[model samples]
Target: MSRTIMLIPIGSGVGVTSVSLGMVRAMERHGVVVNFFKPIAQPKSGDTGPERSTTIIRNATNILPPEPFTMQYAENLISSNQTSDLLEEVVARFKTGTSEADVVVVEGLVPTIKHPFANELNYQIAKAIGAEMVFVTHPSNDSSQQLKERIEIAVSAFGGHKNTRIIGCIINKVGAPLDDQDRTRPDLTEMFEMPSSKTNTNLEVLQMFGKSPLRILGCIPWNPSLVAPRARDLAEHLDAIIINKGDMDTRRLQSVTFCARSIPNMVEHFKPGSMLVTSGDRSDVIVSACLASMNGVKIGCLLLTGNYRPEPQVMRLCERAMETTGLPIMMISTNTWQTSVRLQSFNMEIPTDDAERIELVQDYVAGHVDKHWIETLTQGSTLPRKLSPPAFRYHLTELARAVNRRIVLPEGDEPRTVKAASLCVQRGIATPILLGNPDKIQLVAEQQGVKLTEGVVIIDPVTVREKYVAPMVELRKGKGLTEVVAREQLQDNVVLGTMMLAQDEVDGLVSGAVHTTANTIRPPLQLIKTAPGANLVSSIFFMLLPDQVLVYGDCAINPDPNAEQLADIAIQSADSAAAFGIEPKVAMISYSTGSSGSGSDVEKVREATKIAQERRPDLIIDGPLQYDAAIMENVAKSKAPDSPVAGKATVFIFPDLNTGNTTYKAVQRSAELISIGPMLQGMRKPVNDLSRGALVDDIVYTIALTAIQASQQQ
Candidate 1:
């Protein structure tokens, strides 16, 4: 079942729409796929009227609609006592809105709007929709008694409603608490819910209300930024034409300044976040506004009224001054007085156009809202936490940034490599050391329309040859290498980049966008060598499928292995999966599950499973299992009922290269999967190989995985 919240206002001007939208954004930020619904909206007169809160919300959030209702329709139903029909309509619309999302936030009616008893009407709506109420009250200095009376009225109104529940209340726009009223909670709860037996006039209300059900969740302080109107918004509201639209979306107009006075005196009113309004023919004040903008004075905007255009020569001068600054200029057809009225009436809502205020609310809601309350709302949620392909790819960048290791790319002159390096640097995931001539790398970057920022470390392998010659000679002495031979070996960019990693100059090296996997891994095998206890250097492809990230091991290495080596590959693949945030549930896949079929292949997998299980006792591993039984829960139940890892395998260890290679390709070709690596494991230092046909994003993710591996080894 989805979590449904009904935001009911105690009175007007309580910022209900903002609070509701903020809740949606907050839930969305925490990975909840949330939807929105406004059951009742106040009547609107014409097409040119301001957008309803629901219309604004749907547009701003990029969530499409089932549009909200106008109160006139709901008013007719309620006036004729057709509450059942009204409630059913709301319920039907809400179901449509929630069909695909995790939580649906239903914005209900505000008090003192149409349907004078809308709070009571809201209770019926809530009961029909099965919503929990979160009552919102605007509190102030004298709000102690006012809040007390309102709470009693609401509790009494909704008390006998069987289907609805009061989840909580929020003390909104609180300047502070009253100094004289008893501020203790137990005493306040008593006043809010009185005894029924006595009479509930004081006791008349108590007759219905057993006890106040309000749990005060939070108190959000009054913030002017949250309610400030954008200069662009006001311009659009008045049908005012914009002369210069620069930075209008971000420039907030907190207060208005009518500059009908002289320049010297009007300049005194030119405070930050104040919009100056004057007749368009007033060139003196217009020039003053432009000069203020040029001098870094943040006057929100300049509004020219009375439909009078500036002289051609004066307009040219004003445009010239504005060109040096990004201040907004607008022209209004109305006189100063009427324009001022429009400004006062302009909606200070979280409109689709104002990204600045939306961002502010995202931050505010994150900080002030009760986190426990938010979590409680989602505690019974059915939203899947599956690592989807896009989500998985996005998360890889985050994990890579955690370590920020240096990763060298050997194919720097290749366009894909250069573009990928720029992306890695731009995302702060890794410091990519691109090995190529600086000139050629820049030429390739320019061709790709990507700039290789200073963050990309460009080094000519030829220039770095002298530094690596001695070190390479020492590392390869066991193979009868001389300084002359080492120089020739280091001439290859992949070799040079690998030598950098082996010498501790860089944390990892990723190559092979243009080279073969053998060519990429050869230098590392010869120089960096395998880890101490590891028997072989194996490679695993991080197959990013539609719903999850899976590991296909030994697909790029070890053509065929006996039981012991197969066990090691399985163990290593499991470790790799866990290192990258996937808990290893190893499936030693074969043509048969258990002893259902017998052959050399089946026996080899069964033995390998036993050996792998012995190696990592804590791991959930099972083997001699077919792919269907391993990955599908229903198949596993029928084929290998008791195996822990059977249905949930994230790491698949292939029995040999022929099976592994072909299966991964089939999966990729058929499903259009994004395979990130042939990420080599068990190296003393980190060195991963990429596919020759890898996209820019593919290379970026490989570099990230290499960096993460380097971090783990460190």
Candidate 2:
């Protein structure tokens, strides 16, 4: 179960990243599993400096989420009229990234520069991911009156839809002074709107509503030093090396003070926590700055320009003062004007390696932000979110790691298979036994630069012929097998691997890398046979679509199934889904929806659904529904409103292989979805097959599934 909270800015520079990450830190401190994601990261010139906030939080947090795709692909999809597909992929990734978390912090984009397409991206993302949103507005941008108008306009624009839930709003970067008078004082509304107004009567008034209005959650006061960049950060970004690293680790460069003014005039302008930039030959000005530093004033860092250092005597004096003052000195080749221009575009980030900054951010947010409101939002018995691709992959890995079963592969010399085995062993997901010549396998691995980790065993299939020949003949003598024929069959690694699984030598077997599904599963069918009370083996694909990981059954096997075979396939597929932690909602899919388009195919599906229900009475099974009705709520409401599994079916059972195979492939290619299967079910022991064009990750997950299946069977 998960609750997603999306943070959006009224405009750019509205503190979206700070609040999003801060909440993750706060929620996590209370032992809550908090996950963070930035789904639509826009890349420019192949640089990702803009996404440093996400990098910082992920580095400092416990969540290891998936990386975001560049917005270039999303733009292409939008221009090509594939917005639905893009939205699906986004939701799918969101589901995967946050599936295991109690709360998910979805950080969204506010256009850094003015743009045309920035209007509803956040709203669309919120709706697609089923998340409630909280808006953050910068109070320093405008006065109390102007800020109120902007807030009203932004709320009207962003929360127009009836379903849009604006949980609260945060007034950040408030300009009010902290317990100090005699400054330019903006009213309390400018700082943050209270529940009822008690300050300046000239300011705008606010009225809170019961359910739809924006509630006040946080009022963050203006803090210049808290948002400042470190001296070393500027040095690295500017390609300038530090001459002295004294206290560079702790000092923050808040504002830039140009020493273009005279020494007498700039003395008044030289404030604490501000970088001082000037020409290198200005020894007179440097002496005054050192005197000020020696007088117990904090200066951030000193930058000398034009690639020059001070004279020997001046340098000695400056070094002596730096030792006592803890000041960092930097020299840059660029002149003062050029340096100022370069610093104009420099973006500051919370350093990924700075534990002190991380703690400060967390502590600051916890102190000012409303923990009471966040507790009310996150503390409850929330319903389970639909299983997403990221979540499924993470859970699959964890389950495989926990079970740690032994799964063997016959085609170990195959590159993808070898790589997958190496990954499984390295990740502690499984122990793999490769059926091939160990020397040749190692040779191929070295040629491919694939290092095989420990817990992987390589066996020569030819050497195992003597040991398996008697058992092969004993198991297959009914088909007129002899010792000669048995040895010949054992020459094939898949046949020998099947023999290993049949004798319980290995927990599971996965093959079909260089062979057809028939060549791979034929040995298993003949040797291992079906499980207890099972009629025949069928195949299922774990279709990892955008929003959810769906189970599609009999997509690779059974050319045409009768009612009984179809029911058996559904039952097995449901069991597989449940084994992988999905609560099964089975849908018998056909060309019809609840007898609306009756035909032979539809009738067959109806009968199969009935049979499946009788076999497993507790299963949430519905039938005679089309694909849309099975998965879409609106279509189900129109077509099969009373069916339990109509709109939210997690397992779909197709009527025949012709329709199922075509549909799964079409969805996979057209939507850029991932399919991890054609996994053969109903074997006495676990044996799975792979597609010829399977990726390395496909093989890895298939092996993980095999390991988990082995554990379940045991």
Candidate 3:
């Protein structure tokens, strides 16, 4: 699809240049052609050229041969005062460049408060270029909420009526110590799970922001190489010994100097991966080694690191190296030690395990990148066809363990259950079986907005009375209930549907709109009797927000479950996490960390932690932790120093529903994060519950997630 991404840099003192370069590097890794543009740059007096960020972008993407048009600077075309024209110029340039390149990344100027033009600029540029916004936020404890507020304000102030889609947020320069913490912060990235955050790479940060079809891109680390420094500092940081010295030479090697005194000596130590530098004073030796290393030995980098004039012989050698190895001899203007120090202080954390990053980025590009936009821009060309289904499904059996996947509707005299059921089947998300009259089901779907699809199997309760009677009798065979009594229970009607799931006739049942939670799950519990070892079937609310996603467990089912039940809830929640492509890191949430506080509430969680571990020995489980200690690494590290689950817990098992629901809702309301479930788990088949107030899109996503869960169980 369309590859153009509008990279809007926000906040003051944020490293926008570092982010831009990182994006280019990441795109290069994917073998995608990238063109860079700066829509606006606040010029400084005595800075007679383009912004420094532009220079960094050029250096990062210099692999592509320089084209006259590709290197165009917007100094004369746009100015800080001309905010309106700036938008037009940026869009025109971006559109023009997109035609030649696979993707174009546009970086906005620094944000402003007094004049407050950056928001307007961002909106105008995004709208004009049809570019999605990848807002960059400097990582902070309150970064998530701050970003949400800033975005809301910007959208309100400058977003206008235009549908400017925000792909995701990138927490830039997420500081080294907290990198791991940020990487696993469910509360932070949960809001944008579809587009997960990239960790510790600026290129990744930029690519995440620049690529269309928005997914949570990974977090980026600060790159040391890009930080300006002297030549000598570079050598020391790289652990290289300096060989040459000169004024002009020092300037050339100012960035990344690998110093050596003599060309011949430096050449001998030039391991294939080693960085080699020769002074112009030693051109003869430089020429000789350049000729020698031309065959199979690939030198990492060659630097002419001194001010002394280079002899013709060295020039010939450099030409030979260029022709044979295609490696540029970078010229720097500083001594080795100075360069080494500069590079040393600027450390960028590069994620070695990036398979997940690639997968997530691809998912975003596949799902959100506008195919139509791409086709129009690329002469009717589109991205290759995707192989996977657009939606996913889950089994009802899986939903029973964690939460009740009930499709609730307004109580009505007419049968609307069938229409809801039909909606489930037609969408290929849920398996729906009619609980009422088959004939009436058809009439109701026609009357309502829904149309029943062939996928739906209508089971007439009256017509199939005998069919379910035997199963009901068998389920209560040992419970001392007679066939007549079992049949009478089925007469409640919804109980028969629940019996279908218990009898393994269907995966699960959904009938809560007309019935209370007690009525909805009572028959299943009485009949199905909590899968094999399950103590109780608890519930977890998957709060899906635009900013993050969270799991609030035991919220809807257990009001104040005892220690034994809480333990079961913990295990079930962790299992549910696994079913949804998330590896469980269970957190037994309490008001106390360790034994800091004493109370019945804390005691229950502590006991539950013990029981949960005893039950699921292999799971990473820890508990009796405050909410902050459970989710925040710094807080967890301090509060529960020895607990493995502290600070990285993905599955939070609250002590009680009140605490669970209240905490989750507070986070949601404060952050405006979307909450998805009470996703039911622990059933024998794929059955889910929907809130009566659920939106169509909410239903669609939940269904997809449920289907995925079901497929995994299979």
Candidate 2 structure quality by residue, lDDT tens digits, 447-559: 33467876788988877779999988899889989999888888888998999999999999998879999998899889999999999899899998755789999998899
Return the top candidate by TM-score.
1
* lDDT comparing candidate 3 with the true structure: 0.54
Per-residue lDDT of model 3, residues 37-146, tens digit only: 76556543234554545554443233232222111233333344554564565556556555656566667656655325566656776777777676665543333444
Off by over 4 Å in 2: 1-383
lDDT of 2: 0.77
Ranking by TM-score: 1, 2, 3
Which residue window of length 10 is worst by lDDT in model 1? 182-191
Of candidates 2 and 1, the better by TM-score: 1
* Model 1 error, position 245 (Å): 34
Q: Write the per-residue lDDT of candidate 1 for residues 22-89, one digit (tens) a residue.
A: 77766654556677888877643334444466666654554565677767788788789897898888
Off by over 4 Å in 3: 1-427, 614-617, 641-643, 665-672, 685-689, 695-714
TM-scores for every predicted model: 0.57, 0.54, 0.46
